[model samples]
Target: MINLKEIKNDLPAGIVVFLVAVPLCLGIAMASGAPLFSGIIAGIVGGIVVTLISGSQLGVSGPAAGLAVIVLQAIQGLGSYEVFLSAVVLAGAIQLALGFLKAGSIGYYFPTSVIKGMLSGIGVIIILKQIPHAFGYDSNYEGDVHFVQPSGGTTFSELFNAFNYITPGAILISGLSLAILIFWDQVLTKKHKVFQVIQGPLVVVVLGIVLNVVFANGFPQFALAASQLVELPVASSLNGFVQQFTLPDFSRVFTYDVLFLAGTIAIVASLETLLCLEATDKLDPYKRISPANKELVAQGVGNMVSGMIGGLPLTQVIVRSSANIQSGGRTKLSALIHGLLILCCVLLVPQVLNMIPLSSLAAILIVVGYKLAKPALFLGMYRSGWNQFLPFVVTVIAIVLTDLLTGIGIGMAVAIVNILRNNYKVSHYLYKDEKSITRDKYRMLLAEQISFLNKGNILQTLRKVPENVDLEIDLSKSAYIDPDVRELIEDFKETAVTKNINLTIKEIDRTTAPTDEKALL
Candidate 1:
């Protein structure tokens, strides 16, 4: 049920995603040491194949930067790129199994604060990664997300080096492109439908080409080198294009090592896809939730196809999805069209695409990054209180200092601590009744869930009961109680008799209390 009417917006958004995805696909592939065409294959399959199968309307998938290191290490360990592809194929099958088995429900366990932090952290990373490209330093590939670079410098060091190798041409293109994009998105699109249809990014990509031509002819100093532009593996003929597709070595697919690698890939790829899918849903303006299990099936199929015909492992990528959302994409049609556009343009006129300056794309991405990590988002999170704000800020900082997965793990830990701390108060009601004070009586009402985590607070409350007092421990509201909690209550019952305090345990769900004491009232 593709909404044909939304094509007006989808078509333009598709074009924008295509523009943003091109170098990323190539860069991620190159970073992973896989053939450049493999990345394109993954991108095309993920966009077209996964879009048709996935329930996510706004999510876009392709070769993920997160998997670059894994792919690189796996390829080296497996002894060949073909062998690694076999693992990718098996990995996809495992993902399909996971989807059917409903393992995707793991996504629901992620706290909201952590998810928000992931989005903001990624947004921060995008800005940091692209700043060098925006400043005309193309030494770091566009898809490199790691803080420690394989190219021999840290993220900050790259930024420092970018300034030294500053290209006047890159500066002009990125600076002007950013200005025009801001004007187009903020002003022009609002003013006219024609401006809306003709997106700011597309305009700047074209402008970059035209400007580079002008620089080459009249101002050589301002002309970017081939290194500073989009680099695609130009396939001259149908045969040449066909030559890029590499088949996996199926002979080793069933081996122990290969199977182990496949399982690892399945777990990592599925986790990354689930995370990105979660993040993408948060960014969607329609507030529509994508079916997570079905999304796993789609990603599984995409990876299988990618591995079958020479492509890196793919996942639901947040950066491209964010780009699509920001570009007004309303349906999967945008992703499908982006795939079609990549296939057609790469086969037909790759050289023309190669002309579009990296600086221009950098500008577009930097703006997207800014939108995700907006200052207002920080203020809003802060107002949400320490529970939400701490994780959000920690996620952003950790992501910048480390990488995506590590940062998320750290944020999740922080979020869980906050949850437990809040639970300490609300898990049980420990208030002394005013009416009971005169009679040396007290009441404690338990929460619906009384886990072992609630034991500490409940113990303190229990110890506060004085000698010669009547205390009522109410478990009527409790649906579940940890054994540790029950034991604690049992221990308290013994002490109550020694202190000459009358104790009553009401509404216990258990059929039998300890044989030593009839504690239940």
Candidate 2:
């Protein structure tokens, strides 16, 4: 069952995903206020351990940006990163329960517009948050959630500070990386056979690292120091490394605060993973539907491993998954390879990785951000109609102004309103207007379920019936009806004589009806 063809097809995609993953893994961990190595550890576990268990052929799991705020807050609130890791481990167990309970289908209930909006919103957030980091401003982390700066400054002002305080080394490396990334597809893509095999991002990363070394000696100008690098936890042995992993302090498990936080993390992470899975599936040329419950289980496993080994919880990240798809990944093999690469790099080449400029990573993220929030994406959403545009725009605005959860809430609200607006329609009818019973009117009748919204139209029509006019209020075909509408009908039936209607109520269970026939006519 191990498909070599699938593995072969995934090589190109694997390489690109590696380029994208390396910087992001570090950035997200940095954002979480956790050790930078924690992210790399999560990535390795997600790619290698989770991939083996996941039902998805193409999904790539790792520490999620959506959880950055949660992780950071949890670390502070819990008073220790180790305590938060305990929560993460517990969260994984909860996710496992959800998987077994078949809760993954809940994702289907969310409208496509809301999901698209979420992706677009996250894209905007990534770009906005990364700007300062790209410019080499280390004053704040890369994933601040609030629209305003931590010290009450605006995004622009904070960005201005970064620009004014710009490190020359950061600017050069980031600028060069971005330039190469921007034109990689246009220039290097057209090169001869061997050069063409290498992707633009890979070349750019390699060049950035090389340039970093060349300028490392006398020109400390180009070299970012160890302070700027990913700090691995102080582990002198494998046992110590394993010991650095955390478990949730079960003493806090029963607390309302801890439960609320756990629920929040579980719900949000599940939704995000589902959305990423959907997007990745869409990108798959083979159009594979990843068994979502299985994905939940795999993510749970990854998070358990991550939490046990001093890492952040995992989700099927859209950026990494998208990169995986774009890179032509055909199987989980690419994920496995990417994970192995992270582990190998960590074990063997931490010194080399520490030299990577934050700017270069920023450049890579900027490119990814542009791809997600491109003007074309906005226009495409607009053309898709208000159903898509309204929620998408709301999500983008709310996220930019607030945070991820707030934006998602706004977008979901818009999506629900749209669904109700589009689905429920009403019209009035009179005793003599049987001719009006066309397809449009019949649609309301045949609707398997009716809500209170249909009551007004039904009441108005019943009131206009001529004296002694025959009427049939049919429920035989209706699968369900709301109590408000039922009560209104009952009241109208009791007084039908005044409206001059001889009405027949069909298919209502006699046992469910009152003994007073007049009360229900």
RMSD to true structure for each model, in Å: 3.9, 5.9
lDDT of 2 at 278: 75
Q: Highest TM-score: give the candidate number.
A: 1
Per residue, candidate 1 scores C-alpha lDDT tens digits across 1-521 of 56789999999999999999999999999989899989999989998999999999999999999889889899988889999999999999999999999999999888888888888888888888888887789998887778988666898998899889899999999999999999998899889999988899999999988999999999999999999999999987999999999999998889998999899889988998999999999999999999999999999999999999989999999999999999999999999999999988888989888998999999999988989999999999999998889988998888888888888889889988888888888877765677864567788899989899999999998887889878889998787889999999999989999999888888965655444355442
Question: How would you encode candidate 2's per-residue C-alpha lDDT over 4-122 as one tens digit per residue?
Answer: 66655566667677656766777678778887778878888988999899988888888887798788898888787776776777778888888999989877776777777766776
Cα displacement (Å) at residue 319, model 2: 2.4
Clashing pairs in 2: 13-327, 86-247, 86-248
Q: State residue 145's C-alpha deviation in candidate 2, in Å.
A: 5.2
Model 2 TM-score is 0.83
Steric collisions counted per model: 0, 3
Candidate 1 TM-score to native? 0.96
